[model samples]
Each structure stands twice: as structure tokens, then as C-alpha cells.
Target: MAEKIKLACIIDDDPIFVFGTKKMMQYTGFCDTFLIFKNGKEALDHLSVILIEKKPIPDIIFLDINMPVMDGWQFLEEITKIDISETLKIFLVTSSETQEDRDKAKKFSAIKNYVVKPITLESLQELLPTI
Candidate 1:
């Protein structure tokens, strides 16, 4: 068996996507545990508390670009200010296929990759080795 991920988070407003991703991750044994947030603000609030308390943060974060009350880009910006672990990996999971978005994601060193929506099992398999 492959090594399990300690924790993984999905920060997106779409309940459907979250549900599906959670289920898929479970099926693939991609992670040992999971965290979820409706939007960037909600995620940031929890993240701030966790950081202040010196709690263990998620090992990976799958962020969506489109949402209300701060998008994925905003979350990325805010996280840069917080003291997060260097091993933490963030992947921009978005529906947008624009070159601009990919270029923008590159600016954030924490962002390991950009994945298009309807994430596949194969993609997760490939990602596990790197993380």
C-alpha cells in the first residue's frame, strides 16, 4: 500500500464537488483524513485559529478559483502571510482553463499544481508520489 496522507483539505463552495472529491479520495485511499470549507473566508478563519493554536495543518489543500466572499486566489494570498509548514502543498482546483489563471497560480510557490474540475482518480494517483 502507498503511504497515506496525514490530512487533506478542500476549500470550495460547491457542495457537489466537495462531496464527490471526498468520496473519491476515500475510495482511492488518498488521504487519512479530510477538512472542508465552504469558501475562502471560512477556511481562512479556521486556518488562523489553527495556526495560532499551533495545531497541525492540512498537508494538502485543493482550492477553487470561483466563490463568494474571497476566492481561491485570495486564500493563497492570505496564506502567504500566515506561518504554514513548508511541506504543505496547495493545488488550484478550478474549472477555469485560461492561461492567465495558470500563470497567476505560478506566482505562489505553495501551489504545486493546477487541476481542472471533475478531478480524476488517475490524477490523484500521480499526485500522491510527489506529495
Candidate 2:
């Protein structure tokens, strides 16, 4: 049997980006159950409740850096303190290509990778084997 592959989540402020990522996930067969939130605060809050309820954490999450409330960096700080570390893979999905952003993402080792905007099939390919 094929291994279960779930497209766990995407936390971004841009709807277009979310739509594109969803389409890419569909094309690549890289994800199944996708949970999307408009900002990192909402994502982290919801996930925290799930964690408390003993819910299965998402296998992978695509998080955006810039937002109105609780930016990705703040969210990362909170999520890392949660008890569900082993069950989650967090990826920073940002439009910024700045080395500062990359370096900031590196500060949190929990982040699986830093993905540039407009996710592509080629980019998705790098993540499939791991999932």
C-alpha cells in the first residue's frame, strides 16, 4: 500500500498564494488534508487547541513571514514551545528572498525549509520523498 500522504496546512496572508499552493499540491500528489489560515496567529492558536485535544499534528505546514497579526516569527516561537514538536514539520513560505529572512528562519531549527513564493512542481519535488 502507498504511504499516507497528507497535505497538512498552509498559513499565509495571501489568498492567491494559498490557491496556487493548493493547486501545486494537487498536481504533485504531495498532500491530502490541507488546513489554511490567514495568519500565523490563527494557525498557532487553532493548532494549540488541537494539540491539547490530542489531535494528530500536521505533517507539514507552509507559513508566511509577513502578516498583520502574530507574524511567522512570533508563531514559530510559540509552536516550538508546544509539546507536539516531533509530529510537525514547519516550512517558511515567504516572498522575501533576503538573506536576513533566511537567516531568521534558521534561528528556528524546527522549520523544515525556507520556500520562496509561488510554489512550483520542482520545489514540491524536493519535499515529497521526505513526506
Candidate 3:
């Protein structure tokens, strides 16, 4: 078996996507712990607290593009203000497949990959080695 990730975070408004992704992660033994947030703002707030408390930050983050409060891009921008470890890996798990979105994602070096919606066990498995 591949080594498990210490922690994984999911920031998306879609409950269905969150539930499905969690299930797949569990099935694939993706990570030992999970942090689920409804939107980018919520995630940012919680992560900011985690940072302040000197807690173990997420090993990987699955961020969505569109959300009600503070979109993924906004979160990315704000998160830069905080001192996060470089080891943290972020993946854009969005439904958008537009070239513009892809191009925008490339601007962030922190983002490791762009995954389409409905995250799968196969995709999680594929990420193991890279993580």
C-alpha cells in the first residue's frame, strides 16, 4: 500500500462533491484526516486558526473554483498573506474545464494539479506517488 497522507482538506460549496470525495478518499486510503469546508471563506478562517494554533496544516487541499463567499482565487490570494509551509499541496478540484480557468491556475505555483469534478478513487490513487 502507498503511504497515507496525514491530512486532506476539501473546500467546496457542493455537499455532494464533498461527500463523494470523502468516500473515495476513505476507500482509497488517501489520508488519515479530513477537513471539510463549505466555502473558501470558511476554509480560510479555519486554516488561519490552524496556523495560529500551530496545528498540522493540511497535506493537500482540493479547492473548487466557484463558491458563494470568497471564491478559490480569492482564497488563494488571501492565503498568501499567511505563512504556510511549502510542503502543502493544493489541487483545483473544480467543474470548470475552460482554458481560461486552466490558464489562471497556472499562475499559482502552489497549485499542483487541476482535477475535474466528481473526484474518483483512480485519481486519488494516482496522486499517492506525487504526494
Candidate 4:
């Protein structure tokens, strides 16, 4: 079996995507636990508190680009301000297929990679090894 991730997070507003991704992560044994947030603001708020408490943050975060109340770009900006652990890996999970978005994602050194959504099992399988 693949080594399990200690914790993973999903920051997306779409319930369907979140449900499917969570189910797939469970099936694949991707992570032992999950932290889910509907938007970047909620995620940032919780993560900020976690940071302050010096708790273990998510090992990986699957972030969406377009969300209400602070989008992914804003979250990335805010997260950089926080003194987060270096081990945190964030993957941009969005429906955008445009090259512009991909280029923009590259600007952030914190971002590990960008995966176009509806995340597939094969994609997750591939992603697990990298993380």
C-alpha cells in the first residue's frame, strides 16, 4: 500500500466536487484525515488559527481558483504571509484549462502543480506519488 498522507485539505465551494474527491481519497487511502472548507476565507481563517497554535497543518491542499469570499489567488497571497511549515504542498485544482491560469500559477513558488478539475482517479493516483 502507498504511504498514507497524515492530513489533506480541500478548499472548494462545489459540494459535488468535494464529495467525489473525498470519496476517491478515501478509496485510494490518500490521507488519514481531511480538512474541508467551502471557500478560501474559511480555509485561511482556520489555517491561520492552526498556524498560531503551531498545530500540524495539512500535508497537501487541493485549492480551487474561483470561489466566493477570497479566491485561490488571494488565499495563496495570504498563506504566504503566515509562517507556515515548509512541508505544506498546495496544488491548484481548478476547471480552468487556459494557459494564462497555468502561467499565473507558476508565479507562486508555494504551488507544487496545477490540476484541471474534475479530478480523476488516475490523476489522483499520479498525484499521490508526487506528494
Best candidate according to TM-score: 4
Candidate 4 structure, TM-score to reference: 0.94
lDDT of 4 by residue, 19-117 (tens): 999999899887758999999999999998988788888888999999999999999999888875565689999999999999999998879989999
Model 1: lowest-lDDT 10 consecutive positions: 79-88
Best lDDT among the predictions, by candidate number? 4
* Pairs with backbone N, CA or C atoms under 3 Å apart (clashes), candidate 1: none
Reference-based lDDT, residue 33, model 4: 84
lDDT of 3 by residue, 1-131 (tens): 67787888999999999888888878777665899998899999999888767788898899999999899999998887787555558999999999999999999888999998767777877776787
Q: Which runs in model 2 stand beyond 4 Å of their true positions? A: 1-4
Give the CA lDDT, 0 to 100, for residue 128 in model 2: 56
What TM-score does candidate 2 reach? 0.89
RMSD of each: 1.4, 2.0, 1.4, 1.2
Alpha-carbon error at 79 in model 4, in Å?
A: 0.6
Model 4 per-residue lDDT at 6: 85
Task: State the local distance difference test value for candidate 4.
Answer: 0.90
Residue-level lDDT of model 2, residues 52-113, one tens digit each, is 78877787888899987888888989988887635667888888999999988888877888
Model 3 reaches what TM-score against the true structure?
A: 0.92
Clashes of each: 0, 2, 0, 0
